[model samples]
Target: MKYIKLAAVVVAASISGCATILSEDVATVNVATSTGKKIDITIDGQNYTVPGVVKLEKDGQSKIISTNDADCASSTAMNRKVEGVFWVNLLSGGLFGSTTDSATDAMWTYDDYVTISCK
Candidate 1:
């Protein structure tokens, strides 16, 4: 029984990373406009309207948020940062778990909201 319990714990630790268990591969970000008017923005080459939500990958890459419309004021980028859960796992010496998170790109995250100034 003791050995079985130990094995179970090892299996769980190997399979579940802190970040992987707590985070997701996709994240939704809220896009809005300062003037509360609907503005068009481009992300990952796809167009979307402000005052909406966009689903983005949790990959560790910076995404360019831009506008083609002349009415919008400026563009911005969403930067990826390492998830805090991954650091916690690392600190806890969960090497396999942290490695799993890193391999699956679950260790990264982006801002939850973005606001663009529109004229």
Candidate 2:
């Protein structure tokens, strides 16, 4: 019984980071245009149409949405913010959990929705 309990604790501790457990390397974000026009935008060198959801990697780096279309305006998405669960894990699960989240880059998150301006 003692060995079983110890093993369980070890497993829990190894996977305790809330952000690491809950978040993924990619997050889906809603992209839209102020003019409500459907246009192609480039993100991370990948072309995507606005007014849709795009899966972006949580790399802790800023992202800019650009387009060759003359009628649409480019937009910048700032650096990802620390996930709320990261803080909670830090306070409750301590440094081990928080560190795991940081190392995995699961602690980072971007805005749920972004809008690009257009003419």
Candidate 3:
């Protein structure tokens, strides 16, 4: 009976340990026109909007991709949840403008990898 109680306690501790951890990595890609116009971005068939005021460098440089830790519900036992917002830009004639009005949100599972692209 004592051994059974101890075994139960160990099982509970193991389960608790697995329930409170989360982690994720995020990547972003930027595409720009040769004339320094707007940038186009698409991820998983979704369009993202970037501000026109933010112009791509003259030499067409890609923005530095970043990763961050995501918060998750401890009681829900989520190993990882990727969540964030991003933007994309579009150019029209000699003027630049934002193709979309608001930032878009993205989410991923613990084992999922997110890729962003410009076309």
The residue-by-residue lDDT of candidate 3 on 1-80, one tens digit each, is 99999999865543331111221123232323334333343323344443122222111112332212122111111133
Model 3 misplacement above 4 A? 1-6, 12-20, 24-38, 50-119
* Residue 39, candidate 3: C-alpha displacement in angstroms: 1.9
Runs of candidate 2 with Cα error greater than 4 angstroms are 1-15
**lDDT of every predicted structure (CA atoms):** 0.85, 0.84, 0.27
Of candidates 3 and 2, the better by TM-score: 2
The estimated TM-scores of all candidates read: 0.82, 0.86, 0.23
Tell me, by lDDT, which candidate is best. Answer: 1
Model 1, C-alpha of 55: deviation from truth (Å): 1.3
Which should have the higher lDDT, number 1 or number 2? Answer: 1
lDDT of 2 by residue, 28-106 (tens): 8998888899999898898898799999999877788888777777565645788888998888856888888888888
Backbone clashes, candidate 2: 0
Q: What overall lDDT, based on C-alpha atoms, would model 3 receive against the true structure?
A: 0.27
Between prediction 2 and prediction 3, which has the larger lDDT? 2
Tens-place lDDT digits, model 1, residues 63-104: 888987677766787888888899999888888899999998
Residue 74 CA displacement from its true place in model 3, Å: 40
Candidate 3 clashing pairs?
49-88, 50-88, 50-89
